[model samples]
Target: MPPTKLAFFRYLLIDEMLRSRSRPFPTKEEILEACNEKFGVNSISTIEKDMAAMRLDFDAPIYYDKRQKGYAYQDPEYKFLSVNLSEDEMLALSFVETLLGEFRNMPIFSLFSVAVDKVLDGLELTKKLHTEKRHLQQAIQIEQAPYLKGSDKLGDLLRYIAEQKVIEVSYQKYGSESTKDYLVHPYLLKEFRNMWYLIGYHEASGEVRTFGIDRITQVLPQEKDFLPQEKVNFDAESFYFYCIGVTALSEKPAEIRLRFEPFLANYVKAQPLHHTQEIIEDDEQKGCLLRLRLIINHELKMLILGYGAGVCVEAPASLAAEIRREFEKGVAQYATKN
Candidate 1:
């Protein structure tokens, strides 16, 4: 009457078949004995029904063999079901995987490894053709820039954060002579430009701060724990929606407008800056205009500068002023030198 017992028998039988590929065909009695031995289920009728369901609908062929007088693989060359990703999807996944590796001390690496293995297994079983050699070579040649060290401690901090445990971290603040030890309740781990950051609440200050993992000289699990006072309402995706970088936001999210050179404009259109970005106007003869709604962050500033002369930030008085200040400072430095 119970369906779980039947399903269990079916799974056992199919697994045996897959594992015993080189062995002679297994008979009904052999399957029944194996199922009973493995799962303690003696229901033969349930096994029959399970096999029928698997063979009919699940594409698992459980045909009888004449030579060995038992069941064997009907199609040994069957393929596994796998999600076929496009070039862009593959690129995005590869990028994220590489970036996430900065946290080598994290327990997340094992989980990520399992998922990646499953995906690779499915693709390996089903893939009809290998990646083109020329394309693969080109992709390999496309090198990502080198990154800073200290991934082991980063990983440990991330694991501790995921467990919601308090961690004592010895951190060296930038431009500071001394290092400080603090009990931190880590909330999130974010990656930008192959660097790792832990967003957490400090015990002493009771304020949420983002700490660079590189600057965190040491991290260890603390017996003392603290709950988030304000529930840490920040969503990384929503919080980082506006700004070009990982800079914090004081104001509400805003819509930012930018003009890109025709060459870079089309590229920007194809590969959007953010999920909320859109092309407000397109005049190829002049240039293309893009509008993005996101939190203004330090990461965004670096990204804007990355485009060099190909793109210009056109709106938001605060952002424009910041850009002007940076450029004017550079100009002043050169002028004073002359």
Candidate 2:
């Protein structure tokens, strides 16, 4: 069956559960009638399975009362509840819903949109909870991020990737003046910092590489046969274990040491820079020394620079030199007195 139809059916079951919470318990026949009114069809088998799932999966206290000739709660006060949606879950979904607002008209997520709305309806949140969600959504607009023009192509790209097929991708790398087209073997998609990246085996390079979805101008199907990804052997899990962001790769990780000003010591203690960060030394006058085992890359450079004078690279002299050079260049730009 179509996924949307199944989603609507689930909605009908939730409606029936909540509707039963009222007086005058509803008969199975009445439940079917209500579902038919909204969706033009109903099935005894499907409804039976939904009821069973509700009981087994969610511990709903539903039972058939022969005296009322209807389905009612075995325990009168036992409310039919959706255990899936706690406050935080709803908030996360609301954020995703808002993020997806930019592409609501895209057919790729039409069924997904219906499913998300159905899940929200099933939650049956209180007015106060709903209001809190609305207020949080208003605090920031996730849809206002840099527009990714060919985002709608993600669904099709995913489909081709799942089938281990090749695709003609028109991708323009960062800082490039022109777009480049290539036959890429779609392998995996990754997301970081609210942006998506495609990890594909470039037919041109014979190696797996990362491409930002935002920079992909087009993804078209290839007439060539599917490429077996087993030979590529790129493990997505470990590929990014020692990296930040989705840019250049390093040959190997290094032990990076940094010292934070005494004033900012507590802040770094509470929120360390990386997972490998460790407090190796602490001094009131000399600042706190922390260590991290990761590649020195563009992201790490920007992160250290953002801390300004509060942080300094104490070890890995090369990394320190790189940061110092950038700072010097930055100072030179303002030295002109623009």
The top-ranked prediction according to TM-score is: 1
* TM-score on alpha carbons, each prediction: 0.69, 0.66
Across 46-112, the per-residue lDDT of candidate 1 in tens digits comes to 5677678766755766677677797765776543233557867665555554444443344546567
Clashes of each: 17, 0
Highest lDDT: give the candidate number: 2
- What lDDT does each candidate get? 0.69, 0.75
Off by over 4 Å in 1: 1-9, 21-30, 37-40, 64-70, 74-118, 122-135, 139-143, 153-158, 176-178, 223-230, 253-322
- Global lDDT of model 1: 0.69
Poorest 10 consecutive residues of model 1 by lDDT?
A: 125-134
Report the C-alpha lDDT of model 2 over 198-282, residue by residue, as the tens digit. Answer: 8887877877888888899888888887666677777667777888776647479888998999988889999877788889999
The stretch of ten residues in a row with the least summed lDDT in candidate 2 is: 14-23
Error of 1 at 133 (Å): 6.2
